[model samples]
Target chain A: MGFLGYRRPDGSVGIRNYVAVMSSVSCANGVVNALSREMTEIKPIIHTEGCGRGLADIAISTRTLAGLGKNPNVAAILIVGLGCEFIKAPGLADQIKPSQKPVEFLVIQENGGTVKTTRKAIEICGKFLDYADSIKRTDCGWDKLTLGLECGGSDALSGVTANPVIGVAADWLAAQGGTVILAETTEMIGTENILARRAADPAMGEKIKSLIRKQEKLTKDILGPLAGLVISPGNIEGGLSTIQEKALGCIIKAGNSRINELVEYSAAPSKKGLVIMDSPGSDIFQLTGMAASGAQLTLFSTGRGTPAGFPIMPVLKISSNTELFRKMEDDLDLDAGQVLAGKSIEAVGKELVSLMEEVVNGKQTKAEINRQDLLAIHTVGPAF
Target chain B: MQEQINAVLIHPSDNVAVAIREIQPGEAILGLKQKISARQNIPRNHKVALVEISIGAKIIKYGETIGIAIQGIEPGDWVHTHNLKAEEI
Candidate 1:
């Protein structure tokens, strides 16, 4: 059995056909949000940084915006900008032009005002969606799937059930020649040695180890002893203490697959297999990075449960326990709690793969159906 | 063969098990030899030491050392922030 997806001009397959309405800077967010509210097919990508920042900050903001538009799930893009922002709307559109997707831009200051820009953006989006609708879904090979693995509100059961079970599914997808992205750089602190050992070569292994060391040192330097309290209170209440325990549970979601490459935040993986993305531990931030990096969907495991999903793709929620699954039936999609009930990890993992097939074939997850289209980009360095 | 699984020894070499459900104090943990009794109220999803561990000894879970015991812990003692330091605070 194969999943139905739309093949893009760049040779990437998209599970969802969406037209992105994005703000080049925080100033254009209102117009982007207005357009998103008018149409279900248009996803609004809003963020706070884009202008009046350091060079590094501006570059990351620009790169991330370009990546958002470049995501395979996005069929076309409409960039909304304030004329004076450092990251220009037309320039960002130019970055995505290589994909040969329909791209348009409007500047609020260059036009009459917010009202004029909103109207022009809406008109452009209408055409983009019409073009997107004409593109047909074809049955695609499993190798086309690029999955993002994440876990939040984690507990002990997350490691014992959800994470490990999701790991099985991740390994299965990688074995089928699909790409699996593992994120949360902070969570890699305590388990660096184990992960580094799995790297493709000694240099890649050193890279993994060095990245962990730098992230740990940076957090400690900034937050002092508070850095050790990396795990949330919910995690503690759910029986995890110290960054090490949470890191241990968090690493399992990547499965037992070897680390193929380490990519920077929001950067697409050039190779397949288990690719580690250097992203922060925040759920929405990491989810956004993964989506921007070209993951068609996400496999998010949670013990405490979260309702957040990405703006342009499906986020399949797997609950660690039967109780949370029962409580959040409206938000969660799969139940790894069966693993706790004596079912094998392999069995639940197979079930997860079938669920992924259903999702790729146009089935909306609970979060998608509820329209929990949350998004956030990782920003480094301070805005001036 | 399966008995009531109230706790899970994640790895064969693990010296601790996570409680699947809350185990009340003094309840005999079934499916284990030597008849270990819950020394205190072990909450659901929390770890319980399977053997007496001396101070500074490593606390093993998932067959890896998650932390070190800050104080001496007896079998079935709830191993958490109080008794175990995630690696010497």
Candidate 2:
């Protein structure tokens, strides 16, 4: 199967053609937002990770910023900077220049001020948009696509229905020579053993376990002694008792496919069929990491219901609860709750794959159609 | 022979079954002995008591104890935040 998508200079296929205004540092977000606002064709890609970060943290932020420019969806990029941040705008622009896409830089300080920077950035973005618009869409094979699998706001049905259904779609995509990324490291807590069993090699299996351990350690260190307390409230309300139970259910979204590789958060996959990405369970952050890693689209499973979207990638929301689907029809795209009503999982899985095809062929998801809330926050150490 | 309603028991240790649908009051649920009541409008993904239990009894779902009963609950009663309280591990 093939869909009409923009062909990037790097030979990557982009389902959407957007001229992106990216902020090099948190301080320059306002300027980038203003610049995007002035240009009808320019879309602002904002995040909360560029400043006040240590070396490792700044590295992640810089890599993620550069990855956003590398995303196929972004035809051309304009980097806005405050001029003296850890993540330098010039460095980011240089990193993206190899993509053969237009990469421009504007420093708020060098440009004189916010108003002047915004004006200059807007003019640069206008030209970028014109260049972006000049690129025409061409039909591309399904193999050229990479999909991100995600789940949030989960409940019991999430495991039994939506996740597994989405899993089926993941396997289908992988079978078609397409790439699939399974993220949310925190959710794999108790079920890492099961996932590890599907690793392509023993080293990859150990890596899976290592990532889970690192995530648990980080959560404990960050949240302190009462770290586990947060799980109680959501689990109690949703009828989940233990972290193990949630993990088991959460792992179902990975399906039964062999995990081909393990990637760091926001790191692009070298070669992909099915890969595991280390990411937090936070919905927006995980989605952002997935997008930065070059996922063309994302499939999100929700049991209780969540309405999160991404600026560059289309997020397809699926719910396992029919009631939630009905109640949040405007936010959800598919209902796999029928698995609970005795519908076969295979049938629902097939349906999910078909729906994915429809989504790839220019169908707008509920999140994209409504222009729902989209935000990203990367976890990093203090800026030094 | 009739086919049993397909439902995941989660764990062998749990006594309650999660309602996959809006099981009305007095309706006999497949695969279990108890008939359920609307209780409090048990929406999809919500839990239902499989056996009558007094206050403080642990509520099990997904084969793990999710919360404890805050009040006496009858079989078929909906188990949610209102009637169940989360306990520290």
Candidate 3:
């Protein structure tokens, strides 16, 4: 099951070769984004944090930014900074340099101002892009792929169609010895029992339960007894009522594969098969965390429609409603709404798996074509 | 042959079923081996009471209790945020 990909020196495989222009803090986002826009190969990775946060918050931000640059899909990285930021640009570039990818750093303050820094950043990015574009795609095995599973803007048909279709794909990929990481710890609130039964051992089962309990406690601590109402007006409008009801529907996306391990946000998986990453239910944060954890690609299922995409990984959007699919054709890659229209789940699932194989072999997703690369770091605290 | 209601009946214990499409009031909903008229204009994704429910009874969906009925619900009446309050898990 070898597909055309860029086999990185670090033993990871990437379907696309992208030179990322990463901002170390919110202050440098405009410079990075502008620099990336000037060069076709350089993509901007922007976030809202990186300055004046607590040590724990800064660590999370720094680690997440470094992880994105280290992602195999990124052939090179340009770290942009406002010299006084808490997460130093030079330090972040140093962390990713070990990946053997070409890395550069630009400080706005040191460069005099935004205009001067933007020019220097673009020139550096152009050089990185030139170097990155020279890397050729080679044949890579399915086992080298780590797929991320996520669902957002869900509706009633989510559980009955799109989610299960991805579940089937996840199960198939897992059986083939590839890795699948399911995120959104909040979505697993009430479905712990079902997920636990699929755990490789009793200890893993307990770990899964504990993760759910931790999410419950975190929400309770923030919102008190009415924490269940966190599903919000949107979920209710989409037909979801309780967290338990949403959790039950959400868990259907994980498939029936054995849970091999549980990993923290942005932490790389130790084993293959199915792994769970503890992440907030926020769509962008969840997707970004998975990308940070080394997932080369992500399958995003949405019902009401979301256009979020990552700079490094290609997002395959699957829609459960055919109407929404047609309405948002530019943002969606696959439509599983047929399953809701009486088509068998197996048929749609098999088709989706083939689509993933195509995507791995260089078939550009809708997100790529639309140039919808939305990048954000999961910051833990507010800036001063 | 009559077509079954194009809706998801989440739980066997539930007295309501989710509507997948708009159903005008008085239209016959074909399912559960019974023909029940819609008590009101049920919008897509909204719940319809399958049986008369007393106030304070849990509103079950997805084989789990989702909320509690804020008022008495007649069979075929629409159940939603206005008539149901979120239940603590």
Clashing residue pairs in all predictions, respectively, total 0, 6, 1
The digit string of per-residue lDDT tens for model 2 on A1-384 reads 578899999999898898888888888889877776677566788777777877788888787888888999889988888888878889899999989988989999998999988878777877887798799988898888999989888766787688778877887888888899988887776555657778999988888888887777777788795774445675656656456556756765656678999998899998769998888778998888888999989999998999899988899999987999999999999998776666666778898888888887778899988876386757666545
Off by over 4 Å in 3: A229-245, B1-89
lDDT of 1 by residue, A1-384 (tens): 567889999888899999889899998999888877777678888888789888887877777889889888999999999999899899999999998888889999889997788888878988998999999999888888899999888756889889877888898999999999999998888777778878999999999988998898888888886765567788789888666777877787887789999999988899999999999989998998888888998999998999989888799999999999999999999999887666666778899988888898899999989989788777777767
lDDT of 1 by residue, B18-74 (tens): 788899999876544557989999998888888999999988865567888989999
Second chain alone, TM-score for each candidate: 0.91, 0.77, 0.86
Using lDDT as the measure, the top candidate is: 1
- Per-prediction TM-score: 0.86, 0.80, 0.80
Q: Is candidate 1 or candidate 3 better by DockQ?
A: 1
Error of 3 at A46 (Å): 1.7
| Alpha-carbon runs more than 4 Å astray in model 1 | A229-243, B1-3, B9-17, B22-89
Sorting all predicted structures by TM-score, with the top scorer first, yields: 1, 3, 2
- Assess candidate 1 and give its TM-score to the true structure: 0.86
- Candidate 3 local lDDT, A16-83, one digit each (tens): 88888888988999887777667766778888888888888878877788888888888888898899
Residue B55 displacement in candidate 3 (angstroms): 24
Query: Sort by lDDT, best first: what order?
Result: 1, 3, 2
